[model samples]
Target chain A: MAERCAIVGIGQTHHTARRDDVSIAGLLREAALRALDDAGLDWPDVDAVVIGKAPDMFEGVMMPELYLADALGAVGKPMLRVHTAGSVGGSTAIVAASLIQAGIHERVLTVAFEKQSESNAMWALTVKTPLQAAVVAGAGGYFAPLVRGYMQRSGAPEDTGIRVAVKDRANALKNPYAHIRDPNLTFDAIAGSPMLWDPIRFHETCPSSDGACAMVLTSERAIPRPKLAPAWVHSMAMRSEPTQFAGQEKINPVSGQMCAKEVYSKAGITDPRREIDAAEIYVPFSWFEPMWMENLGFAEVGQGWKMTYEGATALDGDLPVNCSGGVLSSNPIGASGMLRFAEAAMQVRGQAGEHQVDGAKIALGHAYGGGSQFFSMWIVGSARP
Target chain B: MADEAKPVTNIKTPMRLEYRYSAGVATSRFLRGIGQGKILGQRCPSCRKVYVPPRGSCPRCAVPTVEEVELSDEGTITTFAIVRVPSENIDVPLPFASVHVLLDGCDIPFFSVVQECPVDQIRIGMRVQAVWVPKEELTSTLQSIRYFKPTGEPDVPFEKLKEFL
Candidate 1:
């Protein structure tokens, strides 16, 4: 049997469109140091480190992990970099946890970040190559058509996307580290927002943020007394498929479904919608909230929008999703997934503060990337499994 | 700190990279066919699926697709989006309808912009046809086909296009 792993430390920077006050290394160190403080340990206590982020082109940095070794205290220690597009954050944390679960290390630190203000993500995403159609405008443009496909298949209300945007922004008010805390955000504001990509309004899209998130995972035997309760890892999984292939399911990707099924099974969750108290899923676009809800098996096909309409995903609902305001409120692409994972742990540890679900014991963290082809998820609980 | 002696918070650095990208054998064949005002796709022997703008191999079967199949220039829109935001890479006018056209007889959809019709009229299942540029402007590039335009055919039923979506 594998050794148990516990998340005893979690930290994140106050995400914003531009974190100009610090360099990339300084930004990472801020979160890493805070995580170490939470774990009641210093850099020397960490046995290894794992780092992750989006494409280096987004920040005009190549192989940033090599330069960030000293900042993360990975010198003379095992340091690995993971790149799975936006899912890198969640995958990074899973890798760190594996070190403890495999009895390879007592304590491991994992960090993921993105400094989008340094370079243009749009330009980086839309880099033109020879002989190919430059039809895809950006991430929004690429996903809008799939959103339209989902709308046609589900027959969902036209305002479903707007409702999600409003709900997530409202939830952002409770998250102190969230980037966008628009108290005045309303359904009308989102409905009237410019339609940058038809079926996806401006407010429905995530902002380009500069931020970092870090966590410290330790073997159960090495768990130390901390300021907060430790979140025990119940299960974790990662799945991926090709970006495009004949008969591929773009809207409700099969990889995500398989990944969710494996995680829920390993966590002994027969009914995730009831067993899990909260979730922090990747929803860069507002419509993806419903799409992912169905994909993650939280709701039945074509019924996810009803959950939003019925207020089942709100902070006070049965399965409160994205209580940390999620990627919609604060999206540092590289760290967004890790933020979800960390926020899930926070919920189980009762450290989510204002956004905490009442007596949340078990929580789920989910992240998808690269045309919805890559998925990483984990289950955490306050009570050891 | 005095206002005049304030430290610089950020420095602007614009970078550029030039690359020589090869289209490879299969894509070169597809581009050459496009230059000749014909649409070509490669057939996967194992799955028997035709892939337009072929990538030389079938992603699902993991085998080389050497069988060239000519497909209709007409297609049905599987999905579409109206882009109001301007992109540095796309030269199309604002509020253009970018669509995934499932060309007749091909299994995968071809991504391109649809023009000469109102943006609101661009819907899933609408029939469209490729509009090639002037003959003299034809080159070994997909740009030879300027844009796709509505073919005035009845929209394909949602059920028929469900598999493509």
Candidate 2:
């Protein structure tokens, strides 16, 4: 078996539309420095660094790791760059954990970020290429039809998306770092929002954000002698499949299910909805909260929306999901995945102050990317295996 | 898994984007040379492989390719595909050929449009030369080279062009 690892520190920037105060490196360093301070360690304590981000085209910076070496304290150390589209942040964290798990590094620093103000992500994601199918609209346009398919298949109520939007926006008020903090958000406001993509209102979509998230993982033996509780890494897994093929199901992708199964099995979780005390899932679009609920096996097919409607995934529910407001509130493309991973760790460690679920012992983090083909998930617990 | 559903064959959509690439040092120099009627390649000192449309670093060697090499405008078509279907970005008429031009002294071939020949006449190892825009109208972009035209020379041996392809 691989060596055990625990998350010793976590940090994230205050997500928003623009972070004009810092350069790209400065933005990363802000989160990294915070993580280092939280861990009570210095740059020399980190054995290596792992960084991930979405397409470089999103920020007009190609292979930015080369320029971010010094800021990440990898001047003469091993540094790995990961790019798995939107799931890159979570994948990067997994790679960092693997370093400690494999007995390679005692402490590894991982960070992910996106500066959306530098370029228009909607345009970047929907750009036309020669000899390819056209995606005239942005992400909402691309995913609206899929959302419609899910609604049709599940026979869910038309207001499910609006309910999710209101719930998450209300939750964001408790999260100071969240990009969108609408304390007065209500179902009516969401339902009355403009329809950017049919079936996806303005309030139902995630905001474009500029932010970063960082974490410090340590081998079991290297855990700090005196510190707040650390979140033990129970299991992590990633899965992928072709983006599109004949008869492929995009709504509940097989890759996402397979990935969840592996992670749950590894963590010895028999019933995710009951056993997982909390979940920080990637839910950029409001409908995705339920769609992913079904895909991740938390609810039976065509019944996941009931969990949302019944408030089972809310802050006071039996299984709290996205207690930190999730991607729907702060989506910094690259960092969104890592934010889920970090927020899960926070819940397990009892570090999620206002949004914490009472006595959250185990939590799950999930992220998906690239037409829902790439999946990354991790299960963390307050106790050791 | 649920029973498979019917396959989707076609869906039409449109996507248009505007981007400003910083075109770092290597690329800026390469584009400048193109505007001046010269094809340029950068040599990876470690691997000795030359790259056209010079990049920040060599993919194979994982090292910066700095030494600039002047490449001949004339080259051989290492491989090509005939376009039978038209799309929004493809301005060339149907049956036009897109070729991988292996410029002389460069190990890697660059993709470009091949014209002045019938689609049926296009073949691997075909000799061709760049058709540049008028010198007075030159700009720091690949558009400086309108297309590649046949040079009427004997085809390069298939064996020699195989590795380049």
Candidate 3:
């Protein structure tokens, strides 16, 4: 278990489909330097670095950390690469926290990113295993079927997915660092857009992006001096199971349920829906908002769709989710999970300007990956855990 | 319409990406087992759990699976996906089914494909058996089973194969 860790710094690139202006190393440094600046620290203050991503094939680069050591200022420092599929970003952050919690390092810099401009995401996902039939065409392709399943099971109104896309995009307009900021976005355009997979539409899908998210985590003693106001890390948790099994509930996976329960217990929260003021959840597709609402115990099973319909998950709702647009607006696969974790910290630190939840006391940072089997969540509070 | 109906030489810039990974010790052992025409699984001493497509340790117990077992190539299809996309290490016709096959004598199911049949006929609980590659072509992989085919027997009862879930 980690002793105790706090997030002192957070930074992320302006997400977009193409970042032709910089190399993969340059992109990572852009986010890292800004985070160090935010924390009021220099390179030497960082003792180690942890990097993460969805897969190496996404950029056609293998073990990329070895090539990016110098750019990230991690050549002389220990660097670890984490890949728990999409949850890798959150796991990388947790690994950094563990180092601080374990009394091994006072300060650890964690960064996760993906340069999707270099290769087609569709092609990367289709990389074959011998004799194994391929069903996934791309991120959108693999998830489309799941979205259809969600709609079928929940009987959620067709307007619900459209509403989620519109709401998150509207929120993105307030986040300067968000990848896609089209103020012209509206519900009708989303509803009228081509349906890529039955219930999911093109406008409703997350954009393939090139961006990075970074954070500087420190031990208890490392805080209280020389940095911008820091958000104390209250607690963190991760859990996983096989990708699929018969009788496995993919929509609201049991592993996600256990992970949430473990995290809340460690954080000492009796009622998350009331105790936590806000949240930033992973929602690459619009349907996940309701699915996660139930999985996180914010609402009952099969009633997650009710939260969205009742305006409980909206921006001005009781608990605003993904105020920074989330994966729904700017999805840089590797960095997306961290962005949720970082955005949650931004809320507690009061750094979130327009999208702030207004004096958030405690918040939930959630991320899941690999057919919804891997879950990494944290409960962060303004007050110490 | 002319271009759409054009010949094979009329195409353009195609998308191609490949990954080359080091088959670390665990993968090496798995493939070597295939090369020898044997199905080997790693067993966790502490939990006594067996993992096919063997890994270094039990994911749950986080302890090493140092023991080995040779499993049978016959099992039932648990669930599957039909492939319509072409990719590396596989060259099959469109609309082929990829099924999770629980090999006989193994505790868990590993991924494999079924051939010598139509896609619509592939069903869960279908009895399928492995068809091995020629010995010289074998490597450390589940690919040692060239493809699974219907055993042409009465389908296995759901109650007998319920543990796969």
* Segments of candidate 1 deviating more than 4 angstroms: B1-4
Which of the predicted structures, 1 or 3, would earn the higher lDDT when compared with the native?
1
Instruction: Say which candidate scores most in lDDT.
Output: 1
- Give the winner by TM-score: 1
DockQ by candidate, in order? 0.80, 0.02, 0.09
User: What interface-residue Cα RMSD does candidate 1 give after superposition?
Assistant: 0.9
Winner of 2 and 3 under DockQ: 3
The residue pairs in collision within model 2 are: A136-B14
Residue-level lDDT of model 1, residues B23-89, one tens digit each, is 9999999999988988899999999999998999998888999999999999999999999999999
Error of 2 at A160 (Å): 0.5
TM-score of every model versus the real structure? 0.98, 0.71, 0.75
lDDT of 2 by residue, A74-160 (tens): 998999999998899999999999999999999999999998888778757866642222422556655665676677668899999
lDDT of 3 by residue, B14-124 (tens): 446566666667656877888899878887677676677776777666666678888888888865556554444356566566666778767667766789989778766
Score residue A109 of candidate 1 by CA lDDT: 95
Model 3 docking grade: incorrect
